[model samples]
Target chain A: DAGITQSPRHKVTETGTPVTLRCHQTENHRYMYWYRQDPGHGLRLIHYSYGVKDTDKGEVSDGYSVSRSKTEDFLLTLESATSSQTSVYFCATSTGITLQETQYFGPGTRLLVL
Target chain B: ELKVEQNPLFLSMQEGKNYTIYCNYSTTSDRLYWYRQDPGKSLESLFVLLSNGAVKQEGRLMASLDTKARLSTLHITAAVHDLSATYFCAVDSWETSGSRLTFGEGTQLTVNP
Candidate 1:
């Protein structure tokens, strides 16, 4: 298993409040991804960083943002939490010359917006 | 747009039975991945198939990919209670070096005694 950890394992915040989740890795993987898992929706990509400061929006990037200033950390922030945004967030890391490599995941962060 | 779909969204099987889960993708891709997730837990990767007719097996589970049909299958042989979990399949294109994976809606499996 890759050494990936997500801080604030669980959180509950009111709607309209700003929230941030942190994903830290010790494997020094070049690729980091953030995804939100909802019931019946599977895992939707939020944002991903290919390298330090090189990131891109994913399928579900409308309400989220991410940053990767260092090789081992990627952060996902919600500007204003909404009830629909409540879901389990996961962080994954993969490293290889190609994207075909298998991705390793962190435990997960459960968030609830009331 | 890429879409990955899994069939039998929910399955309940008795222990020692056999079942197969199917995954289909909308577009062409270079690889497919199978992952298992326990309730409230993170995903654990099970297989990575890169080409058509590629097959891999671990324990009681076997996975095969048919790129021509854009389909993948995960077969459980003699299921056990401990095999209960949600399984997901993800596909990725071959265009970029760090392309993201588009995941399918997971298939939740429950193994009963």
Candidate 2:
């Protein structure tokens, strides 16, 4: 509802297959983040982008890659999906580095690899 | 690397009870944030504390931060059933990028009538 949208709300892919999740925002926020939520691990940041084409790794960046070719679009790709990568993914965007600034989150995309 | 920890990983209380959740970080941070999440849902922002002794409250929940001690607390007053959910605290390190946040494991609270 905050202008951030995640595509493929739910997807089931076989192990060893490639998967790509899309996050689009209309807010023109400079910072974008991709996080994964698991049952016991809470929310873990996978990757984040500060500006278009400028991205960095997070605490849990293994096995995931992110691309922000444009201001409004960020893509997360799983080269070869594994069962351990199954979780709900969330995308968030904000204006700048100030933590006090609120971040807008998208509805989350659930992925299951079997 | 900064680590954030939350106390009483899980909590259960009845209606109208008062309780507080604690968050401790390993390193000094100028900014701390509190977030709530329901089962199978994304995080919802609760409070953001920017400096030492910063306090903010909304409805029945109150939050405070002590940057000097590297700690933050979320207190619930006269809790209700609707307040049941998981709460998390994150720290933004001074050297780290502004978009990066190190999150605590989270405190799951269950409120019953």
Candidate 3:
């Protein structure tokens, strides 16, 4: 898991409900990312944070938002969950000292929207 | 936008056989990564190819990158049953500030004894 942990490993929620997933890292990496995995789409980045309070959208950022208030924690929020958003979410961290640094992933959280 | 495509989406091989998985990307990027994921488990980084001819090997797996052609290959030698897993290739997006990775649809492999 590379010292990264995602809370609520498995969750069952209803449509239109708000949900927040938390990612915490003990390695103090400078870069954090949120990705979602589906059956045929592989993994798509939702958002990424370079530092505290600095975040940017990825290719699939719609319907999702992210916040990084602390160096060790990154949060992904869904304002109103939809069935299409049901997927396995992964949190990854990397050392941003170099551009080629490898990203380490955490145990994924499985979200199911009913 | 960078698009990555992997061939042989599903593979079934016998133990002791050799196989290769190919990844092709649409755009240019010098940095490429390979990852393996087991059933119901998180993704594990396998190789990082940072140059045009970068090649990395671990255990029975070897990965190579050709940035000119935007192609990467993961070769398995004397495959074992334990090597069964889904493999993914991700290309670094230089157009983005965060070095976002664009991943290919994973290749699912099954090694039969």
Interface Cα RMSD, each model: 1.8, 1.7, 1.2
Best by lDDT: 3
The local distance difference test score of each candidate is 0.92, 0.89, 0.94
Indicate whether candidate 1 or candidate 2 has the larger lDDT: 1
Candidate 1 per-residue lDDT, tens place, B2-112, comes to: 999999899999999999999999998869999999988899999999888999999999999999999999999999999999999999854353667899999999999
Expressed as tens digits, the lDDT of each residue in A35-54 for candidate 2 is 99886676788999988998
What TM value does model 2 have? 0.95
DockQ of predictions, in order shown: 0.68, 0.63, 0.76
Runs of candidate 1 with Cα error greater than 4 angstroms are A98-100, B94-97
Rank order by DockQ, top first? 3, 1, 2
- Which of 2 and 3 is the better model by TM-score? 3
* lDDT of the structure predicted as candidate 3: 0.94
The lowest-lDDT stretch of 10 consecutive residues in candidate 2 chain B is: B92-101
TM-score per candidate, chains pooled: 0.97, 0.95, 0.98
Instruction: Give candidate 2 misplaced runs (Cα > 4 Å).
Output: A97-99, B94-97
Query: What TM-score does the first chain of candidate 2 have?
Result: 0.95
Task: Say which prediction, candidate 1 or candidate 3, comes out ahead on TM-score.
Answer: 3
- Distance (Å) between predicted and true CA of B30, model 2? 1.1
For model 1, report DockQ.
Answer: 0.68
